[model samples]
Target chain A: MTTSVNPLWRFRGVAGTAWFAMVYLYLPILILIVLSFNANKVATIWSGFSLQWYSVVLDNPNIMRAAKNSLIIASCATVVSTVFATLAALAMSGPTFRGQSVINAMLGLPLLAPEIVTAVASLLFFLAIGMELGLLSVLVAHVVFCIPFAYMPIRARLEGMDPRYKEAASDLYATPWATFWRITLPLLMPGVVSGAMLAFIISLDDFVITFFVAGAGATTLPVYIFGMIRMGITPEVNAISAMMLLVSILFVILSWLVGRVKQ
Target chain B: MLSASVRRTGLLAPTVITLFVFMVLPMGLMAWMSFLEPGTYGGVQWGHYSAKSYIQFLYEWDLDDQLVLNTDYVGIFLRSFLLAGGATLATLLIGFPTALYIALKDEKARNRWILLISIPFWTNLLVRTFAWMLLLRNGGLAEQFLSSIGLVKEELNILYTPTAVAIGLVYSFLPFMILPIYTSLEKMDWKLVEAAFDLGANRWMAFRRVILPLAMPGIVAGCMLVLIPALGSYFIPELLGGGKSLMIGNLIQNQFGASRNWPFGAALSFALLTVVMVTMIAYNLRFKRAPGADK
Candidate 1:
């Protein structure tokens, strides 16, 4: 907005600092990806480029099982949370009700609460209920944690939408269900998809909650990576991490694109 | 056609119920258990309620059965606060300029830069911390590069130090700092800045008086986002500090894990929750007083 030709306006130092910050933020991830392909068993040194670690990760049953578990949990949690969040978004955005702010605050509580509290609370709750601390508990916890993430975007989308479309459908004698299915759902699809993608990423990358609530044989990839790192670093760990990072990056991009579609 | 309450209930019931059972109930249970005694083993003892766990946070029983003030847990809390605070400051220094730079860019470039900032955030935190480990270890890339450049005469063995933990925390939470500030800057009305300059205010004075105050909400939000999580983070310190550095998160985790002191763990957790709740309330009150500050 400032079109002045002042000498002070051409400061290049801030640009350089920004670039440096970006590099600092990204260099570790780039290094990890590069190290995952290094032939050396040692993580820090680069003997040469090789794909052996990727193969090693593939052959390892434990890593594969953890990946499978993460996938299942993320998928299930994303689906359930997205559905419920869509319903909630629809409800909250449709009517101006008393106590709506209270409901909104409750929805956001999990996001604001510290992860350790949520983790320990879920752990104790499972113990108190005599429920097995396995994939089911993990799934339930993930759904609860992810609903706020899914709710925000969907609610934003709903609020942005014009109410006239639904009114027109109703004036044409369309039932409420038909009006929803034909009018609302289609418009809300982009937000739903994006929110679900965000939730899936959160569920997939979760460590603290999974570490607390996971029983034997319920290790998610992040939890597995934590255990492996404690033991020692290895190229195989790097390989698995690289794969996880790739998946997460893909989902983030997809979410971004879906979010842009609403505009 | 449905009643307003019925419609509201129908839409919100599923999420509310799920969150209640999983989120609210667990918190309530944790609060309740914090008052009870820890069983000999891992779980809580049912009927014996006491404030011993809460008191134990400040005092410990010696062999002679006298309670003495314990500073070890207090030290851990202070250290956690210091680390989180340091990281938040570091992010502010680095992120403010970065957000400003992005805001000054063209719209397409701004979006790309914003996306780039988020990529690292979306990546698994464990993996990112592991990458830091690989970099900071002896003879690792960071050391090798620094030594090669004659920046250090000795090996860079910062992996297990408090410095490393701070670095990891900063790296982990930097994006949270950047995104909010960028949002504020991007939404900012540059006309006010132009007006300030036209009114004969110098650039520094304009930035100091006008830009900074307008960006306060984002700065506050970013600080909270980075500071709260950094305070409670366990893995960064555990991995980078190599068990030498202990924070409140590690303390709570130990009680729940190996220490098997459930009541003490619950009490520590409640302490953490109390801190977070206070921060949130402060933020809420601030926002309420200055509505549209964030937008």
Candidate 2:
């Protein structure tokens, strides 16, 4: 109903509840971020702020190595999945074809299936084929897993686009290749970039799939953080986590901006 | 330069092939492995096929080799479902109002609020769950605050309990619930609501007649998103449940890791997959039938 005529009795309560929910979602993360700078080694206690934990995390060779590995895997997965997903999205957004729904389902399956099932199945698949489980295997699995994330944005962008641009290019006697490269590709850049960024973030933040498929020396940051937590909690973990949160937030913002630009 | 058919083939083949090789094949292998016997170690035995794993899900072999009805594993499944259901309900209660609040806000304010929700969604779930552990453990901030406020007299020890697991879960999935319901509410025709009010319907009756049906698709979607993931979640239970409470996810992980029973783990995974797939298909059908549902 109109806000003027019949003010909903629950309006104030709903607004208050919403604010509370937001605080509830963010408070723990805010706590972690603050504690990362705490001078005390203990996680729960609040002492004077210091940059020691951040420095310590930076100096830790194992963490640095794991971070490097994560970068490599995420970059590779992002590029590979973005390419595959773009192509698939392009085809999917084009003329309707027979068995299109089946193809759609296949593309959507990775997202729909539980991560554990995919992780375990990937592990078993690798072992069955006698493939060594390491960075390479993790990369392949990540690319496959990240396809849906990459595809969704690109598909959305394509679907949002007018078909007239492509038709205009072709009507002018431009080759399909030239039309795609000059007309379609440039227009699709925002979607491709956003899709790649999303894929990178998904690959970077992934733990369950990476944990299952990763062998010794193949640990990503999340898996490494899991190991550290399993050993015991410390401020170092907080520092790294805070760092990760910053990066993920940055990527998300970048992707959001890219999507906004397309509009 | 390329024909349409060729262009389509060239574009789509790589993803199809990749998905087939990695996604479909692995699932097929897991299905095949479920019927096979476990090796002495972790891998499956090639030719020793049996229905043992499926039977083991419901019946355990005793010392006397008797087929005993095993309620233990069934209990674990039920517990997982109950916890997931609880988490879904909790998130819905919180998220419905949050989504409605956001939907009612101005465009600029709505975007900022939505961004706030997305930040947590993108944050590493393990880190978030760890923060919960830090808060919920004995003598932690939660306990200190509660006691300081006279809400409780003793230290909080919710860290390793099922309640802690539920809290972690609802926290993890609240955004999934919020975003979808917000989409529905934001796009809804408020004029209909006003018309109902003008036609002599009370606020509750107006909402029941106009708003709830419009929001049902989003509610259903949000419920599925939260529930399915919660059911299969291993980390929350592992971290918050103190490795004591076991869900089907943990059970499946154990079958592969500690138990070294590949067949059994595959069976458990396949079962979970079946349940999820059915839910997804039902969701897709229902979503398709609903007008203005998210594509």
Candidate 3:
């Protein structure tokens, strides 16, 4: 512990812990991966080695339907939320407007507060307004939570941005709208992409909020998996979990690489 | 300039209007609904309002003759705090080492380490939660391995405990801790530690005296990122801790769903809001007090 400036002991300690932590963090997924290849309908049983469960999950129309619904919802939520969040980011980061602090807090509060609160609040709001619980309500809920993620990276980019880029565009006789589209959008694309990716993943992973807001007909993938777990489990859930983990790991690497490229 | 600004109603109109309709108004409605009692089937009784539910929360009777009152929401709040605190501590204990190592490593090594960490982060939280269930449940690896090793007198019932909940919560949030710590460690001036070493301090001593102090800001940010959500995470405890686990999140869920007590849930949400606000203000004050915390 006492090799202060040498960098060697620091490296050794850190590397050792990093490996340990990585394995610990990933053990669950590793278990699921091991189970996926196990030839068994029972999650705990190792009947043999087979690709049957993967085929089962792929063949099941209900899971496919739910997953398709989920993809549609996530895409809609991400696109809608990211656009609004970007505009809000632009507005807040621009000239100091009235109620800017309130606006900023409103955007950020969803991120800090638990999904339970947002779910209940949205449920109450929808009820009061007579909106039925369905895919639309789920979309509304996803967009609400996704905004902060989009706003954050975009806002950071905006804050660090030089106003002169827009100014120069204007000086070159570009219309304000044109300048925003041509110059601002392209420059802001990286942050927007990361933020949208974040929004997409959040919408994909969300359960508590989605469970409450999504009604019977609009059951999303996570909710379906949750229902299966509760109603005397299934091994397909494990298979799905393995696939989801793979996708998530891929998405994270992709986002990080994209972020680095922008930098 | 004024005319040009006015012309860009394209931006202002949507921004102002959307925040009001979606963000601000929903919160306001929730606060209002929280003051009213739940109706028979569901929803508010429209005009009725009272402080009764909030008061009752302090003293509700349980299935047992004990004063189980209001599901002891106060206990749930405190337990959540403990859980969050534990997870934050665990994450930092491990994360500090990893981030320090990465920051101190060669650029290529650091990049490789970061990519490895970021991988688990991409999956949705539900997938991550399910992964844990797969690992700890009855038929899963833990029970199988432990039973094989004679670690279990009977079947090990580890799932649905607070320990399981904490594991899932920590697994989900560990990245938040690492990133901030990495940023802080990356920004550190290694020369100070080198100088301290040259002046006769050993490795651990330099790390303790120089690197740790400089890295405190990142640690604090990391803590905030992890702690805030860990306190509020409902799904992890619900799934891993099982149905018996009633964190404040579950309570809130009940209020909106089966319990049909919107008013009490609103009050609970408000309570959470006030706590978060106070903590944030305190955090800002401490940051200001620190000698060069921001810099």
Candidate 4:
């Protein structure tokens, strides 16, 4: 402990800085939430607290449609991404092969590469295949990005698990598939879920790829928010965003709770 | 040997095929497309090829007004990097203490603190960015609260500026930094730490000597994870950036969007990909490592 430095300044400064940073980081979030309840229709001015914005957002058919589209896309993407990721995880950890090095590098590409690159490629791919840019396109595109997130934590979980148990199951008359289906999947559930959750979250928020790959009629929520954004700041955007924040926070909380319960 | 090999291959077949088609093929095609010209109908224009599209962007299309063209791209690229780099540095600085505090604390504290850190990750990035838009805009909370006092007289619009963009980028990406650093810090060897302290090193010295080096891999991983994609972030700068300037992401988007010059955009995309791939290769070279290496 240095006696030369004043304890009071150090103490207050550290606490103050930390508190300020946290507040600064979170303040906009708080403000958005607060304004979402504003009774006034206009965003530039505020009247009073109101739940009308929430109702308006909910009551709007477009919002509901976009929400449904998002939910279906996310769920499908999660399942596909989780399944493929498990395969990739098994590949990366189970055995090495000639293609192993190539797969490893490719597995990380989406994680590291720019969204625009893949977004462009996805658009081109669909075009080349004569597939219309619609729900299916977005679903496949989202899944492509989600696989790496799914692969990572699940791989970690597989690595951390006791191999002897798997071996025991294999020795007992359980087929490799059966052992994996029962023991491996069960033990790896948390990582799989975590990965799925991460994948879902990412798919839900992805705008860049979603923006380019989506057709005009298939406007996802993110694309909707982005399109509306060009019109300048408004309360509807705030109201919609606040609702989205709630949706995301809810998913995050659910995932965390699920993780805790399993633990 | 052959039978076991076949067995392993059978087990891994689906993963190999799925990854090859979706992951490997798309990237391969993109790399291939980079060399070719983008067709008008959004496919690659075959047989009309040169590196002209790429060269044009790097040299700013040989402008009459060099300063103006340079400002448009060179300046914007530099600004974007600076902003992303600044955000990365800040995340590291702030995330280090928070991660250390959590990792060093008791079990209860660790759980609570980590939960707090993670709650924000679930919220949509767009929503999160929008939240900042709400706070930073004119007559918003920050401006109103400040002006209500004597801190600011005229209304200050903090939204749609570089600083606002930085705030959103930093806020969004901070967790990526924290998670890895926390992992590294939590996995630090307790005995080495104690040994450093016992060997007459102070807290700062012990930390510097024993903790920082061990955490370098995670730090490097976290920074790479945060900074690379951030350079191509369209939304953060788009909404917060207010369409004021052109980022590489935005530029790529423009070529693909209204500009209708897919070749030029693809060329730029290749530029970003090349930079990222080279850097990642360099990173892996420096640390051809696995987890728990030091341990």
Highest-scoring model, DockQ: 1
Clashing pairs in 1: none
DockQ of each: 0.71, 0.67, 0.50, 0.42
Q: Which candidate would rank higher by lDDT, 2 or 3?
A: 2
Model 4 docking grade: acceptable
In candidate 2, which residue ranges exceed 4 Å CA deviation? A1-12, A258-263
Model 3 bad stretches (over 4 Å): A1-12, A160-168, A257-263, B1-4, B7-9, B61-71, B149-153, B288-295
> Clashing residue pairs, candidate 2?
none
Between candidates 2 and 3, the one scoring higher on TM-score is 2
lDDT of 2 by residue, A93-179 (tens): 988998788889898888888899998999999999999989999999999989989999899889888889999998999988899
| Residue lDDT tens for model 1, A1-263 | 53325554443577887998989899999999999999997888999999999999899999889989999999999999999999999888865878888888789889888898899899999999999989999999999999999998898889889989999999999999899899999999888987898898899999999999999869988999899999888888889988888888887887788668757
Tens digit of lDDT per residue, candidate 4, span A1-263?
Answer: 11213221122133444445566557767778888888876674679988877778789888778878888898899998888888668767775667777777767778888898888767766766688989988988888888888888999998999999889997898987799789988998888878988998888888888888889767789888877777777777888998888778787778778878876
lDDT of 4 at A258: 83
Interface RMSD of each: 1.6, 1.9, 3.6, 4.4
Ranking by lDDT: 2, 1, 3, 4
**What is candidate 1's local distance difference test score?**
0.89
Residue range B1-58, candidate 3, lDDT tens digits: 4574564455556655665676667778988877787777766788888775677668
Give the winner by DockQ: 2 or 3: 2
Candidate 1, residues B168-222, lDDT tens digits: the string is: 9999999999999988877888788878888998878888888788888888899
Please report, in order, the local distance difference test score of every candidate based on alpha carbons: 0.89, 0.89, 0.79, 0.76
Residue A158 in candidate 4, Cα distance off native in Å:
2.1
